[model samples]
Target: MTDQSDKLFTARLADLVSLCERDGTYEFSSFLDERQCADAEQWCKTNTGSLRYRLWGGYENARRRMLAVYPDYCEEYVEGDYPFVCLTFTYRREDKLTHRDFLGTFMGMQLRREVIGDIVVGEGIAQAFVTEVAAKLITTTVSKIGRVGVKITDSKAFELEDAQKFMDISGTVASLRLDCTVGLAAHLSREKAAVLIRSEKVDVNHHTVSSVSHELKEGDVLSVRGCGRFILSGINGSTKKGRIHINLRKYI
Candidate 1:
């Protein structure tokens, strides 16, 4: 997120903070992916002095979230005033659709990706979160997803559980270094993990981290491109032999 290499995006984030400060009112943005959210958080750390901010995704545990920048006086109004709406799509149970289908269809319409949030797909129901401006366009236009007819409704109270699944990965590593933890999370050798880090295949906390010896703290999120995503959930006590015991949640 703080990668000086990506200066353009960082500059845009700076402008958002400045806008919020100058207006002394609530300023929100389109839905942001995990990587973008991380960037926003990093950029705001040193930049936003007195402004308060949050990244809400319209629903709980949302993979995509929107940024809310507001002053202390407007703190109570920010939560209810997020500009995103949730749209529920009801379809035939036999259609056997997927989240990818809904997402691809939305993008095919030329809707900006940042305007879309989480798409919760189910047997006969799917929910998509989007900005209010984008919601008007989708509700008025979208009726089918790739030949499968569907009904779309604005259901603000209707909520669906996100279907992300994960596996438990617990083991002891020589240390909490990025390389050591990546090896355990991805079932790769320590040397191989180091190689992947150097090749820019491992990202810690949504930012590409190439240092093998980078210290990984508890609750750090790691994404190993080909392997998958993982969270360093816990760091238990070390064994008598000095190896560190850790708990990882590997997203399946």
Candidate 2:
């Protein structure tokens, strides 16, 4: 995220937290991308004290989510409390729609990006998580995504088939430094990974980190420009050679 945009988002998020505290009610934010979600979570953990919050995108492990800030005494969340709905778009298999196609069509509707969450495209259908405000209007008036005719219906679940899949990768690195893991994840030499880091081609948890020495932990997501995205899935014990054993899940 850009510096200016980051500050503005943080400022707005601060307001949401305060509103929940003062009103003793849940306050919801518009959809947040992965980067924004990470930042918002960090902010809450750092500043919110005892107040509780939820970052959910309609389903477990959702890539896009909304910020739901609630009072600490509030125990759990129910479907009725959330402001999002999952919409399914089914079309002919021959239509061959892309993620960009679905998102572009929504943009054509003059909808802001924040109201739309994850748009998971599958073989013959796409399940999109959108705010209740957008879902009502979209399902009623929109009949086609681009030129392909689609049947739109409200769904309680977003199909897992459209969610990201990963290829298991296990390796040992000298250290959990950014360069070490980047090289392992991207299949580049350590030197090449260092170069890539300095050249501004690596992002950890959606934020660019240029330092090759940046320490990484399990569950950190790394995105390389040419290489696919990856997750540091596990950190097992060290090998006989003293290299740290690690498991990576690369997005397929």
Candidate 3:
């Protein structure tokens, strides 16, 4: 039974990849309606493969339906009244080519603010997906990605407040300026920055540097391990003693 299931799953993945490549894109988002989910879940049950299809749509609609049907599947909710959702599925394959192809297609489409929830493939798939996404997102030869401080087990952990903090340090930063006052001004309040840096979650130039107070100079690339990376341009000037102004470039 297990062997048959595995064979079916592999074949399906191959079909999916072929469909994507032939069309230059594949979109399952539009096909997710209440009725479609019922059909899919029912179809998945009789199937032996580890791979299964699921639906995502308006938050309440998708959640209510998914939980009622696949109660054993892990779920987490994001706050807000909006119906936005990110649907996903899991496939067990020792190889990573399929996962990379799937992610690459979505990223290639460049949908703005498109949320691709963490894909929980096997360890090998997870590693490959990260590498593929990183390479695709980089524009310049030296692009910086920031970190999210917290390791999220579920999607609900991704909060708006946490996102705002990450932007303050890395997102909205324009440049990494140098100069005494510039450095001081660039210095973000340790308390606010510490939430991320203290966790030893933030990385500078690919090395984990937890010190929020760590002075950054021009041409320094700050990488927040999980969130993303930033390039330090240079400090604009000093607002006052012990306070310098700096800027950082956003990569993602």
Candidate 4:
């Protein structure tokens, strides 16, 4: 079932690319979740050259992004000029709005999920990236999110900084199993890590891997639901106890 889904997704993306090639025009896809983005990137590796595609979500650090495919001649197009519009939502200074809050509110608006990209929560404000049409619709229709009244406006001038947070960690694992690597990166017991994997709370490269014994390799990204996200940097060497020494960069 998973392979079929992946093939379908690849086909859909290829269709979009074909459209761009046929018309000699830039083509943009709807917002893709993390898994979809990873899949699309993998597809690009063997199928299309990097210059033919780009990804953007109105910011340098975005979990969800849209794929833009165009002819090789259109390489000069700036990513910022993509069809995404940033909407800034402001509420009372004392009111606390989280990423989840903003996302839930937008989802409540009954808009298509693909039309929404990323929602970034900042101090007393939150920014959302959506299709141009969704931005215009949201400004007029969205007035409140739960009890907090919100004022929405275009944030075209808002400057996004590179604010991705990560911490480097080093540890030794008995093996390269998913549970072992997750335990080391999250500082949890092996039993707990196995439980998380069994309960479907672990993802590798954005795809859920429920097997605790799944082997992990270098450059793999692991996301534990409650723990956090981490990248398997590399296996340095083996410890005296035969455990593998590894490095991980955990995203805060």
Best by TM-score: 1
Q: Model 3 over residues 53-154: C-alpha lDDT tens digits?
A: 345433322212220111223123222212233322223344333444545544655633223433323322221112223333322221111211112121
Candidate 1 residue-wise lDDT at 205: 84
Give one digit per residue, the lDDT tens place, for model 4 in 1-252: 288987888888888878876787788889999889988888877776544887877766688899988877787874756888888888887998777787787788888889999877666677788899988888988898777899888955555344356799998899999999999988899999999999999999999999999999999999999889999998898988899999999976
lDDT of 1 by residue, 10-102 (tens): 677677778887877888877888988887888778787988889999777787998888888998889889988889999899998888899
Task: Give all TM-scores, in the order shown.
Answer: 0.89, 0.88, 0.28, 0.82
Runs in model 2 lying further than 4 Å from the true structure: 77-79, 236-240
By TM-score rank, best first, the candidates go: 1, 2, 4, 3
Candidates 1 and 4 compared: the better one by lDDT is 1
- Candidate 3 matches the true fold with a TM-score of 0.28
Q: Relative to the unseen true structure, what is the C-alpha lDDT of residue 226 in candidate 4, on a scale of 0 to 100? A: 87
Error of 3 at 210 (Å): 2.5
User: What are the lDDT figures for the candidates, one per model?
Assistant: 0.87, 0.88, 0.38, 0.84
Task: Give the clash count for each candidate.
Answer: 0, 0, 33, 0
